[model samples]
Target: MRMFLKLNSLRKPSVHVKAPGVLALRWRLQRCCFCSSPQNESSNISVLRHLTSKIKATGPISVAEYMKEVLANPVSGYYVRNDMLGADGDFITSPEISQIFGELLGIWCVSEWMAAGKPKHFQLVEFGPGRGSLVTDILRVFSQLGALLQSTNLSVHLVEVSPRLSQVQAQNLTGEDSQSARDENEPAYRRGTTATGLPVSWYRRIEDVPVGFSLYLAHEFFDALPIHKFQRTERGWREVMVDIDPDMADRLRFVLIPAPTLASSTLIQADEQRTHVEVCPEGGVIIQKLTNRIAEYGGAALIADYGHDGTKTDTFRGFRGHKLHDPLEAPGTADLTADVDFSYLRRMAGTGVACLGPITQRHFLHNMGISIRLQDSPLCISPGSAAELPQRLYSAAPAPGLRYAHQPEEDGRALQIPRPAEPPAPLLSSGRHKVGEEAPSTTSGGWIQRTGTLAGEELRSTLREGVIGQA
Candidate 1:
């Protein structure tokens, strides 16, 4: 008999029910509120059984393989489910937090495009664009560039795997039927035009994007890719695997392969100390592809995610209902993710590709003149609320890194802003600097593109005291 051990002490039991029939009724009623639905749970059980059978037949699977199955398996994958993002979902992204994030990014894109002498035709691509909020905000900002918009033939390409998220992204992008709607038999690449007349397309892989001057944005993307975990043992490092828990037939647990193979040995080099490390070869592979695209074609790519510069520690975690959960507890129920090793990314970028700062997000935004934009805006909020903006923008993990790479011909200037010892104090300290005070001038030209008319000035002045940046 399999002895089931409850690993999650934090998980609370359902409310008490006296009668057996009433208990069954209560369970049916309460199932909707839980992380996994009864149907989903049943599906998970089936998947679990399938995995167990596979393991018994073929031996244990790598952590990456397990993650690939649980989070991206076509039929029963966690991302395949509709409810997987936002406040009600597993976790919220930075763009979902504030429009300011995407707006600044749009300004950066415009500046870079101008720096590149304004390419007549280029591809604007986003990888794993969750719900399309960031792209929508970016396009809105792009719309401010009137004549520039007309001159540039911008084609939007979203690289995504989840059909459900693609639908949401389509709705956000076009406000109607998506150009590249879900068709299992659909070719690797599909194209369409948005309601705004901008050419849009969907690609399952980055390689499918037509070669051209391409600007790619990947925010909180690389972390979700499956990773291989290795622990330094007395002899050497061993690869982590997922197998059926001997004590609990229905549960899964991590198990290390007994012998260290050449592949595992070549992949990771660890000291004698018992240290844990994670490597996302999938992420590394994607970086290689991206860097190749930028190097061969003329353009830039910006990757923003919470991670360290090659930290040798295990950062694998799961999130559900805005709270931490055991990653091994319930497969296909929570968001599984691991910290990115930015050093790995830099190394994979290759010889000619120039890499920029893996600087803190606070430093990046501040240097991008987030404060200046906030001061000139027409949003309203309390001083206390405004103070929390920096903290909120501070990622779940510290020091969100930003990497910028471009072709040698297209101005290889790095977007690295000097990091401060600490994040600057809030601009609106103690209610000082009343409305209509002269805002400080910036060296970087304004990308907001305000109309130079008396009525427009009046509107700007009115919005000067608003608190859109408080987020």
Candidate 2:
């Protein structure tokens, strides 16, 4: 992670292609998190100044601290004030890339909801919902569920720190029918209602969201949490620190602490083999909370991000505009993130809950029946890197309920929630799926129309297979 301490040129958005009924975005989904917005460059100078002052007053700060201040510090954080998630912004998300992405994940949610025996109350909790496109696509599927959900009470809860992004999400998800909380003391900082009349509430932290039969989604969210870097040394692992470059007063650089710090001593395992490691304590804490909630209240969590199962070492980097940038140079001007260590997250989940495969994004989507949509679609991969991306980014989650074995496809692992022993098909799949023919149910037709998918029947069988799996 020894990146040059100079800012790179502003980056560009994803390479977009236009074909009938298709938009193929060529970019790595992991690189998509918290890119940058050119509009915020001049205003981002405040964070560098703020970090300089803090480092001078104290000492070299941990990498985690620097990331926290750069990305989510209350005032001048990058995410706090920028619309950084589209063609004009730093990068684009899967949701922004294709409506199909959200629609499939939405189907997964409904599959889990049905597996949960149709709980009277359902909460759709999303963390770091950029532009709200993902959840919007999801709610549309919920709307298509119709009669199945008429008896169920549904609500949306978002955990977001950026007021600027929150407003963008409110506009997209709620049609401007939203308002800020009356006071700072309230747990929900903002609240709104969707066009469909579902309540959407905003919170700054995960624990504040209400507990019940909840479906938790974290798309590229954990990768944004601050991580501490450690380099294996002859004596022991040394924690990486960020400090003002002694040679250049205006610059910042990485430093290695000579002695053992609490993080270096506690976070690493005894049998660790990697020469370099990055640990995200904040991500661990959030996982513990999510799993605890799932174990107690009976729900599921789906986490998708650019990550590894503890294989790679040096992954912490920055993205400005759309290209790799020096993480320390401009501070809040670039997105500072590290690849999420799903292995670390699995360990944090502990034996209290079952941990599933960190499956390939391609496999998960294929299981979700994305191939059914790509049939006639032509893809022009961009930057030559997009072709290399599918195997790199992965997803991990427990099934929405306990009973369904929910075995994963191929190498992907899926966590399953325990409930009464029976996994029913997704509500949309209520009618038998006959390949090459539309589902007999009219709701199925409405679902396909609502999602704007061209293939009406091809997805039914595969999507059902993606749902409850063999025990």
Candidate 3:
């Protein structure tokens, strides 16, 4: 009887598991009461029968092997030891909701490093730099100007691949000096007590830093990489993998297969139904290698995230301390994100890089001024939070049902939505022009799109040839 149906499918499954310090011995198994299987397909067929019985007694193993002793074998892997974010870990980032979102991204990184022309040795990167409070409130607003923070040449990189949030952003960028410590040699700046000595550098790849002309800051970093989910079906899109269970003990599974590529499946079969696509191929190859290194050494990248700018079907989910959970129910112990079509990251950052404003993290921090850094900070000379700081920089309290989902263009009919308006300023200005002469046309009638440059175009071809419009 095929060895009693392969020893009753490798026995073991009377339930009552709970490792760590042991307490799991209850099997008198019988199953087959009209066997229905499920329980995530009997925990992926007992983890593919204990990896083909350990590759037939240890031998042929490559199915791109990585069951890590069958699902994070132990000591977690979802980021092996989490602390994802706030309000109790996972989901809270907008520079963890305050310090006016890292002091208006430190005045939009000093107006994109004075529009890159003032680059002395610019490289103030920060991808996944949580807990470093938006790079210490963008280096305390680049130490309040002070001649553009002492004529640039600043180096404050911090890529971070979580060694537990890079030791909580090197202990919150050497604690204390919460804005207004203008380094007049204010020594002893905490963190493993290195004394005010700020000169940190940490990386986990972006080709191991080193490259130049950098000024990127990712915030919510492309909704936490690792996505690739799918589900269109009816013979078009499928993929969605993850399976575990060594004779059942904390199961864990999700299997689908078949989706090789319906144009890089982000799952969308439509009239054929089944729609759950969610790709992120390493956040579109590290956002086309950080916009081809800022279009070959120039600079400027912000990329805030929430997602939705077209091409539908998005699958990105997770959450911890705040609850929602189940990104494969704890593979590395929770914290996965998604939603960033950013118009396919602005058609893969082309036109030699210059795609500002996918705007709306409340209109790019209220047009990168954060209502004049909250009416010139000191939270406006406090006194019961000054009229709610201009109603928390222009009101936001009416999201009860808020269901939106429409935008999905590229000939799938209308769907480029997201234009509630107000993210035009940031073509970078602080003196002399010419970077493709500050584009900004909107001949006016509404929806006048021009983005980077076209505001004049030979002064509108000299008023359409009637030279200066009949003077």
Best by TM-score: 2
lDDT of 1 by residue, 1-471 (tens): 000000011112221321101000000000000122223667667667767887788877887888888888888888876467653565555564457667766765665555344567757888889888888878866765544557778888889888888877877788664455466556444556676788778888887777776677776677779988776666667776777777777767666666775547877744424366788888878877876666555566766554555654666666555344556666777777666676666666665454444445555567555676656652532233544654444333222211112211212121122221221222322110111111111111121221122123322332254422333
Report lDDT (Cα) of residue 150, candidate 2. Answer: 88
For residue 347, what is the lDDT in candidate 2?
75
Q: What is the C-alpha lDDT of each candidate?
A: 0.56, 0.61, 0.42
Total clashes for model 2: 11
Query: Global CA lDDT of candidate 1, please?
Result: 0.56
For model 3, the run of ten residues with the poorest summed lDDT: 1-10
True lDDT of residue 452, candidate 2: 34
Query: What clash count goes with each model?
Result: 4, 11, 8
Off by over 4 Å in 2: 1-36, 39-42, 373-471
lDDT pick, better of 1 and 3:
1
Rank all candidate structures by their lDDT, best first, as comma-separated numbers: 2, 1, 3
The CA root-mean-square deviation of candidate 2, after full C-alpha superposition on the true structure, stands at 16.6
- Each prediction's TM-score versus the true structure: 0.74, 0.75, 0.28
The residue-level lDDT of candidate 1 at 243 comes to 75
